[model samples]
Target: MERFVLTDAQWARIEPHCLGKASDPGRSGRDNRLFLEAVLWIVRTGSPWRDLPSMFGNWSTAYRRFNDWRRADVFKRIFDAVSDEPDMEYAMVDATIVKVHRHGQGAKGGLKARP
Candidate 1:
């Protein structure tokens, strides 16, 4: 399975926003990072939870942990934290690379075109 690479800097920003961390960044932080990586792998591959690799631990357990995090809005807090700092690797995109189809650009379509 492909891995989700979070840099140490990125992880530092994200770690504080995550739930269930001990006062020390010990076992719990490592477990939380692994759990997060599992979720990210599922998302990156667009794979069903059942197909998660054993390296990430059990698929069902990861899914349940994902739900727990979601219910607590942990993801939102992480997004809010990370979004404030624009990391260059993912920060910029060229609008020229995006293509629009004619229909999407307000061309007449469907029944109107058929008539």
Candidate 2:
């Protein structure tokens, strides 16, 4: 399987936000980059944690770390850190008219039909 590789520029932006760095007080993570890539692989392929490749290390460990980061809101911080201003060039939602069902519209006689 082709692994995801972070470009030097991309890594530079993401490295500081990662937990378990050498400078951090607690035990350092084995390899933040590899862990991130493993996560990316799982997300990109939409595979279960058990299907993670052996090269990425134990799936359970990776999953645990992922949960830790998620609880800490690390992913949101990373996105905010690295993202640029939103591009609104293209319309995200169409202006096409949508039919919405009114409350009790389908009832037998109308709003008073219900007993």
Candidate 3:
């Protein structure tokens, strides 16, 4: 089977979960694939939103989408969904202290620090 730029299966997986109506509802045939791609591009390159390529359909649009998702807590939800469950049984490690450094705070003052 030929691969689509935006695979239908992947689109289906995320489509239902995406929130918000595209800004231009009158001409609202906005594609979520582009939005997702823009977000990925921003993250992968760590670039400013204004630097997004024109092919992503205006940097302002992508920025608006990014801000909307951020305000709506969508990214947090997605992160939680994809992350492994927290290790509740994880334990904190405490160790006996050993002096590794001999740095002195005015050693001539003859004051010893209390532990």
lDDT by candidate, in order shown: 0.80, 0.85, 0.68
* Residue 32 error, candidate 3, Å: 1.1
Q: Per-residue alpha-carbon lDDT of model 1 for 19-115, expressed as tens digits?
A: 7788744334348888888888888999999999899888887888789789989999998998886667865677776878777899666675554
Which residue pairs show collisions in model 2? none
Off by over 4 Å in 3: 1-8, 21-29, 84-115
- Tens digits of per-residue lDDT, candidate 3, 16-108, equal 556644743333327666777778878889999989988788998788878878896877876664444556675555554443344554345
Off by over 4 Å in 2: 1-3, 85-115
Q: What lDDT does model 3 reach?
A: 0.68
Candidate 2 lDDT score at position 6:
78
Model 3 lowest lDDT segment of ten: 20-29
Candidate 3: clashing residue pairs, number: 0
Off by over 4 Å in 1: 1-4, 23-30, 88-98, 105-115
